[model samples]
Target chain A: MANTTESNLPGDDVLEEPVPAMQQLLDNPFLLLFIGIAVPTVLYTIWGVMEIVNLPIAK
Target chain B: MAVNRNFRTCPTTGLVFHEPAEKLMRWNAVVAVVALLVGGVLAIGVLLTRWQAVHLLQADLFYQFLTAHGLNMLVFWIIFFEMAILYFASSTLLRCRLATPALAWAGFWLMVVGALLNNYAVLRGDSSVMFTSYAPMGAHPTFYAGLILFAVGALIACFVFFGTLVVAKAERTYHGSVPLVTFGAITAAIIAVFTIATGAIILIPTLLWSLGLIEHIDSLMYRTIWWGFGHSSQQINVAAHVSVWYAGAAVVFGAKPMSEKVSRTAFLLYIFFLQLASAHHLLADPGLTSNWKIFNTSYAMYLAVLASMVHGLTVPGSIEVAQRLKGYNNGLFEWLRRAPWGNAPFVAVFISIVGFGFLGGISGVMMGTEQLNLIIHNTLYVPGHFHATVVIGTTLAFMGLTYFLIPVLFRRKVAFGNMATWQAYIFGISMSGFSVFMMGAGTLGAPRRHWDISFAGNPFGYEFPATAWLMIALMGIFGVGALVGGAMYLAITVYSVFLGEKIQTPDFATVSAKRGMAPAPQPVAVGATGHGAGVGAWGMVAPGTFVLALVFLTSFVLYYFVNWKYLSTVWPLK
Candidate 1:
């Protein structure tokens, strides 16, 4: 994995640079997008499965 | 000198191709095309016979042609092309020599021989059981043996692909991560390994049963495990073709994924959740528990659907962003309208994206739903759904890629260029119609795999509505249109590869470029600083695609509700 650690070059005054929250989200939009799509889909699917489970099978 | 001896740089794409691996890839692709031709011919017969007006073949011949068509198209043609793709993704894309070239050749021949043997069995009138050779309806032993050999060969090719990846890593051929397209191929190859192994476990026993070494294979068990092989094979195509879609974006527009990490995660979701879709096949089987069916079809399956949705959004999203960066940011659809529409690869991939999503993706989810499956299970709708996916989605993508390969790999100018440009639209639109009409007929309860949908001469003859006949006739007409498009493709590719004028240098982009269109977009250096540096980084450049995604979601929701409504009508509550 590529990581962004503080460099020891000429401008080594800062210890660690914090990545902005918005930039972090921007960098990984698919993650948020996937979660958003997946959560509702998972919930709906679970509801569907429960409905099937609760149904009466013909004798 | 070292590089020139073993590798040649494609002047067009600037990708290095290891010499021996190039030969293997070419051979596999050529044979895949041959298989497609055979399958395409058989498709006409089957379609004509099913049309009712033509009623082209006798019952036995219909079954035979159907069996050959299904196996040749679904198995031999697609897998052979994918073997070539695996080699290209690993050895070519990674700039490494293919590991064990001799073993790769052996694997290729094994696949060829197995394909021939299976074809011979079908042609001999002994194995007309169709692609899913369910037990108790025994095919000749050679049929099972041929399939086994083919599976083993494919397994070897998968290993060779993995080995090439290892070599690439060891040789430091590529820096940073492997390309996203290569990553997607790896996902497909992994799923293929599992699919082939399950295929072997089931098929070897079936072969023995055919040879009288074993007695009484369980019918339910056969159906149970066979789908692990059957449906999972299509899963392999899904992963591979999605990889092609990404590759096409990169090749044509030099587009990068919105987020490589996110895209890769979606692929991982495929590996985990996609195979469970095999359960949808057995949903109506009495022996299986509803819990098993419901869990696999609903819960786990939706994760797989989500993965596809992620891809569906990002692929076009990447293209939209790339186009916006190139000053096509006028309106919501300016980026889209300004796209190189006449470009074969662009048209093919774009059509594949839309058709797969609307026809294949939506119908698939609807059919996989338990109650909805009750409505369309074992009907022609099943084939309708897959035709959209496997044919429109995968085959069309492969066809698009072949245009690029002709000059870069085969070193010949694409012949009949105008035909190639129009071929994607003709084939795509016709197949889209075929799927829609077939599904419509299936909804009216058209029996799949029957010699006659009319139920002619049965002891208990039943009449279908007039609309069912109309839909089926339209399906047949559209099928012929698709066949014409297919023929044009074959003629263009065959002439280009074998007989067209040789070129010292070919401009790859010109194969798809139209006169008076804007010049081909310069390849952009992705992942550079400031590429995604601003407030607009949240895919604001791809607002068109974002709206398209919303439309897709709306379509999915409405379709889901409508299916449930249809299901409610099927079995009314007291």
Candidate 2:
């Protein structure tokens, strides 16, 4: 691999620069994981369960 | 290299592989192909019986083997290979050691055992309840147990993948971002975690019911929960295979994604909305509210479809741009024409992108539509749609990646030099034909999962249209060809793994350095503070790809309404 340390030398402010807001959210695997799990759970599983439970008794 | 710290650097691609992770990947892939071998054998019986002239298997054997075929191909084979992809994407792509290699091996063994037990349960004759072991029709407890074990193992593996990513970051493996391919793999792993959890949610209780510990389980509940596992399993495949498409482009043409932001957002859309496509199976089912149905099938599903469309365009678009940069920019399709037609990995992935987009994507959108689904919900068309998506989309892409992996990871030259390329085209073409004919037979009312569509020996005979019969026969013929193609893939893969000559360093270049280099993104704007923003296209880089996407959109629009037109021909609603 090319010398990454050369680019990451002490004076380079690139390491300290702020990650863009969208990049921050997208790059965090845990946050994305939470969103991925929670959204699907709410939209599909929980909502489907609610609909199923509310069904009137078939006479 | 020692066992604990062993890492091998590929001279060609310059990617480093952790030894344990590589071993795990190799074993997982080998197991996946073994599962494919089992599934392919069952496919022959299934196809022959459907052919009607041969009608090889009896009804009992047919259902049993069909169950095995579905489980092996859909669940076992696909998941095992995905586990391999996860390891590679995380540990190899990110240039880090695999975290907790022992835990990964445990997961692998559990998966292997679970697959064996599941197949055993299905083939035992008593547990022939088919892939959707719907409630009120109980199988042996072991069938549910095996699947649960498999899902648990898969969940464990997903965590291992996530852990590897964490290790990579802490270790500072790559500079700016993990490559786009790794991001896509993470998307797949996230979906996988959700899928396995859904499987456990439904299957555990069903296992109890099968053991007679519970009195009853609701059929409706069973179905709703199962499709969450069932169809969302395909969602994982979508994410994984799409990653392969991106990686294939990079490997074959040194292509970079046009915009990392656009591609990543498309993956983000999948995370939020893709599982709602589980509702595609439920659109025809009773008791589900129309409002609920419409929301899932319409708005939510469209977002997911949009995500797939974006990927479908960008993978090829990126390829076209790379080719154009290589100076093939005469006309719109000159870039495509000048592509490496005889290369196995290139041919396979290109066919996958086109076939999946044209055949699978359009059909999927139509099926997911609430009204259009009514026409072909539980028919041969259902399998036809998935064969395009799952077989052509996922399986073929995986095969392409395998050709690349054989030389790089396995360090073996591909065994069937020219023959492997033929295998890819043959598989792509035959399977495309099979899917179309199957859907045609389905339009004329051929039921899926029926051992005999002819309705032989029934007192009240129900004969389908003659064209349906021809359609089915043609489907069978094409299906047979696909199976032969599948066999060729197996032979080529197995021979290469065990017997093909070893490759010395630099013998095969996965990503050629000097040739096919993607040009740097051009400046989109100049900031006030001397900072400049760059983007993929300085001007128009991929006009050919734009035309192709327009073609796709046109076909999709036509197909969407054609289904609506077909639905209108049904008995008019009052």
The best candidate in terms of TM-score: 2
| Tens-place lDDT digits, model 1, residues B465-557 | 899899999999999999998998899999999998786854433211111111223344552222333323244757788899999999999
Fnat for model 1 comes to: 0.00
TM-score of 2: 0.93
**lDDT, candidate 2, B1-574, per-residue tens:** 3225456667667767777888999999999999999999999988888788789999999989888989999999999999999999998887677888999999999998889888889878888888888888888888999999899889999999999988877656666677899999999999999999999999999999988888889999889888999999999999999999999988888787878899999999999999889998999888788777878778898998999999998888888777766667777788889999999999999889888998898888988888888788889999999999999999999999999999888999999669889999999999999999998888878888778888788897788999998998899899988998999999999999999999876543222111111111223231111111221234567778888899999999998888877788886764
Where model 2 places Cα greater than 4 Å from the true spot, the runs are A1-15, B1-3, B505-539
True contacts kept of each: 0.00, 0.45
* Chain A TM-score for each of the predictions: 0.43, 0.72
> Where is model 1 more than 4 Å wrong at Cα?
A1-59, B1-5, B506-539
